[model samples]
Target: MTKIAITGASGFVGQTLAKKLIETSPDAQLILADVHQPPNPTKSSNVECIAADLTEASACQSLVSRSPDAVYILHGIMSSGSEADLELGLKVNFDSVRNLLDTIRVERPATKVIFTSSCAVFGRAAVKDVASEADIVPYPESSYGTQKLMIEFLINDYSRKGLIDGRVVRLPTIFVRAGAPTAAASSFVSGIVREPLHGQESELPVDPNIGIWLSSPRTLAHNLVHAMNVPADKFGHFRTVLLPGYSATSGEILDALEKVAGKEVRSLVKEKRDENIQRVVLSWPAKYDTSRARGLGFTEDVGLEQTIKDFMEADK
Candidate 1:
């Protein structure tokens, strides 16, 4: 049986990914690890849930003791929270990840590790130019981005040394996220669509013309699983792959919402730009040439309107 472990299994993406994995691989044994239990933990006998502090070395050791064949590393501090609290960010994002890596190296060397990174690793320079596989030289603009870059490098080094089979997928800002607002700097990207559709007023933290690189939660979850199935040889030298995404301005997203949900829903979005939010959002690149990920058989969302429609249908 394939044994897999997923950290941050309590979060939205983790929950979705767990479900997807269970559906696709019915016989696979899953160990879901997080500080708090997931809201709807999998009921399947093949799935096991472990609540523990990943920042603690003992907890990390225990989690890896199962010797999972593949581990999905998804835990991290959100962008705004990371920026606001550097110490906390360092502990959760960097320290915890290092602890996990070390534990895996000692206990389960050569195991496949799929890390969920973000486009925030790119900065203002990347924003101005369309980022590609060759162009992604990370000059992080935020504490969160810097931490992710450092982990990417660490994972790469570990992979090169044959300590682990690491696959780093740098995700775009996933939109139409379900649940309450998060401390993520990109939370507004989802809120602007989700809140209005739920008949709630949503705040717009950036200019209407400001564009962002985006993918739907469904697409990201699919790609995460795909990353696991791809052979290690597929990623020759660099294990990092920037996932494919579409670029849309705030105005375009609003227009799509209006077209699908009607003008009433669109009117609920309030223009209240926060400078801090703008600074972080603006630093992220709006466009990417993710042919590399596409070549690897990863998929992309059709358009912004379809993504909004899917969210409405799924949430309602």
Candidate 2:
């Protein structure tokens, strides 16, 4: 059976990805782990759920002791959280990942590792409206983005050395995400819908015209699973792939919500801009030349209106 281990299995995306794997790879052994004990997404006996402090090398060693064929390194602090607490972000995002990589190198040599990164790695100043993986070195403005870039470099070197097979997929903002407001600067992208639906006020921290690249929970999960299944030989010297997503401005997203959920629900959204959040959010590239990733068979999102409609129907 193909054994898979997913760290940060408690988060929204983590839980969604786990469910996708269970549906597609039922016979595979699923190891769900997080600092907070993870609930099995499917509640299936075939899965193993464990609480792990990955910052502690011992916990990482134990997680890899089972020798998973593939590992999804999914845990990290959100953008604003990392920027607010430098030490904490470094510990959780950068240092812990390196610790996990070390353990994987020793115990599960050559195991495929699928890592989640963000589009925030590209600073607005460096990117000339559109970014492709080949043309630029990341110039991250936020601490969180810097941490992701650091980890990406490490993953690339690790893969190059043949220590492990790594695939780093940089993500666009995921909208209509199910859950409470997160520490992510991009959380507002989801909040425009999530809070409004629940009769809570949502804030628009950035200008309405600011563009955001986005995907749905369904698409992100599918692409992540596909990343693990890809042949290692298919990846070039660089291991990172920027996933495909369409760009829409903040006004466009709000309009989509109004179209799907009606004017009443949309009215709950309030404009309460915060400069720090805006600066951090603006650093991310709003559009990418995803031709490389598309050719590799990664999925793109449906339009914003359809995505919002799907969330409303499913969530209600």
Candidate 3:
């Protein structure tokens, strides 16, 4: 049986990924680790949930002790939260991850490591409406982005040295999460859809025309799983990939929401701009050339309308 370990398994994205893996890979055993005890929603013996504070060296070693064939590194502070607290961000997002890598290097050498990074790693200088694999150079504009970038380089170096087989997939803002708002700068992206659908007033922090790159949680899990089975040679010495996602403005996303739900539901969104949030959100590149990722067996979600419809169907 294929054994996979996923850190941050208590978070929304982590839980979604775990569910997806269980649905798609019945034979795969999973080790779900987090500071809070991760739930075994499936209640199957194949899935193991552990309470772990990964910042601790012992915790990292213990998680890696499972000797999984692959590891998905998904734990980190949200954008706005990290941006607000530099020391905390550095410790969790950067130092803790480095410790985890070290544990993997020693305990599970050459294991496949799929890390979920963010498009925020690309600031205004690295983008002009569109960013591609060839022309892009990351200069993170926020603490969260900076932390992610540092880990990206470490993963690349570790992979180059054959210490670990690493694949860094830079994620776009994930939308329509099935929970309350998070501390992320882009939480409003999902709030506008989720809150209204659940009969609550949603906040719009950016202009309607401000565009952002986005992916659905379901599609992201699929691509992350696909990343593991990809041949190490297919990475061709550079293991990082910008996961495929479509770009759309706030207005367009709300329009899709309206189409999926109704005008009354859409009208529940209340616009109240926050300059800091806008500045942070605007720095992220909304479009990418994901041909390289697609070539490596990655995939993207359909359109905004379909995404909204899917959320509606699932929320029911």
Candidate 4:
């Protein structure tokens, strides 16, 4: 049986990915590792949930001791959290990742490592400036972005040295996230839509015209699983792939929501701009040319309207 290990299994993406894995690969052994127990742990006999402090070397070693065929490295501090607490960001985002890589190098060298990176790697750029596979010189502005870029470089180096088979996918802002507000600067992206639809007031922390590259939770989860399954040969030299996503401004998102849920829901979003959040959000590249990822069979959401509709249906 194929053994797959997923760190940060308690997070939204991890939980969804775990369920997807259980559905698609019932016989596969799934080792779910997180500091806290997964909110919705699977009942399947093939799945094992283990509480782990990824920042601790011993915990990382224990997580990889079983030599899983594939490992999904999904743990990290969010954007604003990292910016607010630089030391904790470095510890969790960089130090923990390094420890995990070291453990994998020593214990399971050939195991496939799928890492979830973010579009934050790109510095402030115009909406017309579309990032592509060839243009991945990360000029990160936030501490969180810096950590992700550093880890990406490390993953690439490790993969080059044949120490591990690493695949990094720089995810766009995942919207309609199911949960309360997170520490991420981009949390407003989801909050505006999610809260309003739930009959709650949501705050918009940036200008209505500020654009962002976005992906639905469903699409992001599918791409993560697809990244794990793709042949190593498909990635050639560079291991990083910028996943496909569409661009939409905050105004457009609200417009789509209004179209789907009605004008009242859109009116529930209150504008209270936070400079810190705006700075971080604006620094991210708002456009992308994910031709490489598309050719590699990574999926994209249909559009903002469909994505919002999907969120509504999923929540109901």
By lDDT, who's the top model here? 1
List, residue by residue over 1-316, the lDDT tens digit for candidate 1: 9999999999988988898888888888999889986544566798888897999999999989988999999999999899999999999999999999988988889999999998888888777678986776779889999999899999999999999999999998888788889999889989999998888999998999998889987788889999999988888898999998899999999999999999999999999979988888778888999988988889977689889988988896
lDDT of 3 by residue, 1-24 (tens): 999999999888888888888888
Per-residue error (Å), model 1, residue 141: 1.1
Indicate whether candidate 1 or candidate 2 has the larger lDDT.
Answer: 1
Identify the runs in model 3 with alpha carbons over 4 angstroms from their true place. none
Error of 2 at 219 (Å): 0.6
For model 2 the local lDDT of residue 257 reads 85
True-vs-predicted CA distance for residue 257, candidate 4, Å:
1.0
Residue by residue across 6-106, what tens digits does model 2's lDDT show?
A: 99999998999999998998888899999989998795688999999999999999999988999999999988899899999999999999999988987
Better of 1 and 4 by lDDT: 1
What TM-score would each prediction reach against the true structure? Answer: 0.97, 0.97, 0.97, 0.96
Give a tens-digit lDDT track for model 4, residues 146-227. 9998999999999988999999999998887898888888888999999999999988989999888898888888888899
> Candidate 4 local accuracy as lDDT?
0.88
Off by over 4 Å in 2: none
Better of 2 and 3 by TM-score: 3
Which sections of candidate 1 miss by over 4 Å? 41-43
Which pairs of residues collide in model 2?
none
- Which of 2 and 4 is ahead in TM-score? 2
Measured on C-alpha atoms, candidate 3 has an lDDT of: 0.88
